[model samples]
Target: MATEVTTLVEETSAVKPNGGVTLPIYMDNHATTPVDPRVLEEMLPYFTGKFGNAASRNHSFGWAGEEAVETARERIAKLIGATTKEIVFTSGATESDNLAIKGVAEMYREKGNHIITAVTEHKAVLDTCKRLEKYGYRVTYLPVQKDGLVDLDDLKRAIDDKTILVTIMAANNEIGVLQPIAEIGKLCHEKGVIFHTDATQAVGKVPIDVAKQNLDLVSISAHKMYGPKGVGALYVRRKSPRVQLSPIIDGGGHERGMRSGTLNVAAGIPSACRVAR
Candidate 1:
């Protein structure tokens, strides 16, 4: 898969003034997949003819791009049973993971400072937890069973009054083992703690109903499901406890100010469209 992605990147990068790069076989769907030519066609007009900033609403161009972005948001929300207002666009799973974890942590610090998670989560989740530890937040890294599953009892035991959040992955990226997210979410809810999952590896391949699972937050990546790269989203359940996140970077207030900067309507819209499928 890595080799195929490398080949595609090499070919795409080699396009000259007069000719396009030719791919040999196109078999690397794991590391990355080829962008659907149809999606590219749909996107071409935005880059040339109707280019406009979604954040800018003073002109027709801005309205057109903003409408497209909202339509894409609705499509993505439909896939996971979330409202469009709950989704926040991001750079990819890594950024989504960081936002979900750190956002909730900072938001709920006054309520508690401890967080719980398993050992087998993607580095994004684990590393974010570790960083929190350095800042006076306590993290409980739960152990997984031999089957690569987190024991529900262990998760229950890890929870304490100080544990404000629980983050886990929806599926194992290395082994494709689906976690019992519904069960885990139920457990968190029972204890009045927030639940978050990194669903980058499981989004398109597995069915995820955020409400059924009682997920407070979930992360997704676009490129994982034949969509454009550098775009993803995080689902933050509105009913969940309010979370405060100090922005890792600051710019124009966007994404409700939880994530700031100009919106990438082009990539965000197509990415959401792919996930809706």
Candidate 2:
């Protein structure tokens, strides 16, 4: 069965035309995936005829672009069991992870100066936490089991009154090990610490219900899920305990002022549609 599955995946990703290798056979899906044809079709108009800044509120072209962006947001939100208002678009998961980590650290500085995370996290996460350490934040890097799964008891013991966030990845990028996200989320909520997950490798491939899992923040990437590159979103929980963050990129107060810049309407809309579909 494993052999059959591997063959099927290879066939689906590339075709050996004329008994020669495909020019670009991609096996590193953890890094990115080729854009689905359906998503490409959806992205074409935004790049060509419907090109307009989503922030431009006075013109018809802008309105159309804004409408498309909002629809995409709704689609992405529905797919992940989150509200449209909670989704903040960004360039990709690295930015999303940075935003979720640094934003939370800055916003909650007065409340706490400690964060807990597993050692085997994406560089986006580990690097962000490292930067925070330079600024006086204490980070606890929990050790994982032999199978690359974090020990829940270790995580529980690491929590202190000064701990403010628990950041973990939903799936391992290289090894494809699935973490216990729902369990971690529950644990964080019980301790009054915010739970954030870099869901780039897990978003479309696995089931994620932010509400059910009690996730406070989630980072996602479009390219990881058969969508266009350079587009992603961060889901910030709005109720039960509203999650707040400081904007990493300050400009025109876009994305509820969490991320401010001209929206990438062209790639973003198609990315969202791919996730929803």
Candidate 3:
């Protein structure tokens, strides 16, 4: 059977009794977006009939939930040109940013103590890098061009033997300016410095192939692309140069031990994977 789903979003505001427009027309998609009804409907069953602990492997319900999660993982991996084992779910892009930056810093301290990022990056990224400064880690906040793009020449100059990681956002949330991610990725790989991109604003909005872009780590947010809130993912490359990170949250060792906790199966799995592709 073929099933088609549609989303009903109110684009225009209705007039009030006094003829004034509605307070918000929801044009601020850069901040957050409304949940698509189709996605909502798709996820409803998991909260009720399909409700089961994905970690519980002893019953049919658990098996079903776990199967859904694996399918979702496969879908997400396909969207980014990655293997299913590379995707790690997180609460949101903020958590993913923290994990990618802090995790790499902690794990690769022996390799180097320096990290590179741009000034136009999201607060989640900038703040994390700022916090690392207090921990004796040297961070180079590269200056972008007047058009809000990072300079490749400047990036080449910034890298050194002590440089461990380079994190740059794929798109500017405020201006919507796209960066030269492929070039940056190629440079980072050649220099042996791990590259991580905060792709919250760019994942679904633009084309991203982790393998083609030579990206080591990439962050994604479901809400940013009309899937769901409070759910996101982090892509960790596992081949050629295997990227390893210390767990920021420790508990049940979920998400392949990179992020340890009970998976937010309902929203995190299906909703996040439904996006980008």
Best candidate according to lDDT: 2
TM-score on alpha carbons, each prediction: 0.87, 0.91, 0.91
Task: Supply the TM-score for candidate 1.
Answer: 0.87
| Runs off by more than 4 Å, candidate 1 | 1-28, 240-246, 268-276
Q: What is the C-alpha lDDT of each candidate?
A: 0.82, 0.90, 0.88
TM-score of 2: 0.91
Candidate 3, 237: how far from true, in Å? 0.2
Name the lDDT of candidate 3.
0.88
Colliding pairs, model 1: 107-244
Q: Which one wins by lDDT: 2 or 3?
A: 2
**Structure candidate 3, residue pairs in collision:** none
Lowest summed lDDT over 10 consecutive residues: which window, candidate 1?
15-24
Report the lDDT tens digits of candidate 3 across residue range 1-277: 1222222223234333454556445699989877777777878888898888878889999987888788878888888899989999899999999999999999999999999999999999999999999999999999989988999999999999999999999988999998999999999999999999999999877889998999999998888888778888999999978999998999888888888776666774455456546
Residue 116 lDDT, candidate 2, scale 0-100:
93
Position 245, candidate 3: lDDT? 92
The lDDT, on a scale of 0 to 1, for candidate 2 is 0.90
